[model samples]
Target: MKIPGSSLVRFPGNDPKLMLQMPSGGRQNTENSQLITAATVCLVVFGILAIVDGVYYHDIKYKLYQDKESILEHIYHTVRAVMFPIMMYCLFAHDFGGVLMIVGIGAVSIDFIMLIFDVKEEGRSRNRYGGLSNDEYMNHVFANTFHFVAIALILAAKPAAAWTIDPSFALGRPYPQVTAWLGSAFVAGGVIAALLHFWQWSQYFSRKVAQS
Candidate 1:
């Protein structure tokens, strides 16, 4: 049984001569911790592989220069992982698929907003070091709002398309194909982003390590 307060390392209170020889801080740090650094390194390596696939996947280089909201470019976004497939299905105005696409987009927006707030609280994600500054806050707000609106438009497009194109035939459903196709894209996007971020972190720390 652990005694209350027994975890502390105690030197004898009465040992006058022994006290003279002791360091001001007590014994060296005595606890062991499970460090995630090793895991992060492994993740970073895997992320590099994913990044290569992402950069070249689906002729992404060409698509990047395409229209900002174009499906081809959206397919390459692979960032949120869902944006593309839902979009593709939406492109066809697959009724249910389009709605789900908006839902997914909403989720991404919410998460991003939460992240912005959380990061801002911690003073992160702006400038070279990635923290929010006053000037950048509006930009962040605008970016998120735009994406959120994009999702809404995407959601709205399908039903409208289905309704307008054919009164007797229904073309849209719950976006199964879009969901399936885009699932990996979303996963790959997350892995890629994490890798890039960690790569930057490692570089920063490596430089500091070298300097020291």
Candidate 2:
């Protein structure tokens, strides 16, 4: 006797081993994999650039966390920081399908909007420091470019079915070794970013109270 929804529960070809197997050679499949790989690389580069800008320039060098002028920027970072881990989980940690994919897209879209606002507010926030340095400005340009490119590549790589409203979930990596490493790195980075932003906000609040 077969169970209800057994088809949904079963792996491809009813073989559990095949579920985690990488796709075999096909031009389209290969292209899609390449796109995902490139997007992952872009994300990694973006992460490094963000660390330089946020940690080295903003936190250590300028100590923007205690400045009232930087409060708006801090607010933007705090929100995006919280969303980053969820976005990374949905994008890299698993093969999200249907509604989950939609959720991931929504998260990315919101982050993009936040990025725009963050950039827009930087002029006012950094004006006290004589605006952004050339190095920091160039860093933002490259990081933003990579971020947009990654989104485009991911959207191109996804199939039409990924947009549909079907409920499906699975615990598996996108690729074998590389994806595992990328996913772990992204998720860890996201968590750390979130924590750092929260700490910055706390420090800022403390400074504000002391000044009062």
Candidate 3:
């Protein structure tokens, strides 16, 4: 049984000194836990893979750009390319919390949905580019599925990191307020990016009607 205030410490065998020397920082003590460290490393590795996937998978591997790119596909790629590096920055440098985390999660979820539109656009374009190869379909599917799983894992592993920033910081802020300002920028960027997609879609549809 664990003692009231003392922590349990076992190292190969029972040792009183090891137990006595243990720190009492609760969750803080677990900041550098093996699981968290592994998650952080995996986050970085996934971020790198996302970068590579953003660059090559859409165009070179899938030939998304071979014909006239669909508005949906272009916007999805644009947001994805912009966000991948910012996501790495959040994982490594900023470690934002609370509202920022919410915004990040919402943005990523929307991006995932946008990917569905992209895939549909691809299907419509098969007449132009021919049917997707087995490798192409698998690669696209894996990239789409892996990102959702990675996002879920990162959130699960670092729940504390998710809400580090307080809502109060958002109020009474000016240009130089770090969290508030930066969070606003992220929100604005997300909104603008989403709007751009719709705007492009409108243009694309209008052109299609004109051509018809």
Per-residue CA lDDT of model 2 for 37-146, tens digit only, reads 89778877887887898789878987777788988888888788777777667766666655666777788888888988998998999998899789999998998888
What does candidate 1 score on TM?
Answer: 0.31
**Candidate 3 segments whose C-alpha is farther than 4 A from its true place:** 1-35, 38-53, 61-63, 69-71, 160-165, 168-212
Instruction: Highest TM-score: give the candidate number.
Output: 2
Candidate 3 per-residue lDDT over residues 172-204, each given as its tens digit:
101123432443554455456446545555666
* Alpha carbon deviation, residue 200, candidate 3 (Å): 14
Question: Against the correct fold, how does model 2 do in TM-score?
Answer: 0.82
Clashes of 1: 10
Model 3 weakest lDDT span, ten residues long: 167-176
- Tell how far residue 63 is off in model 3, in angstroms: 5.1
Scored against the true structure, residue 119 in model 1 reaches a CA lDDT of 39
Best by lDDT: 2
lDDT of 3 at 148: 58
TM-score of each: 0.31, 0.82, 0.53
lDDT of 1 at 196: 51
lDDT of 1 by residue, 35-151 (tens): 112222333343344344335531253222222223322322333343333333333233332234345555556555554444343242123234444444454454445444444
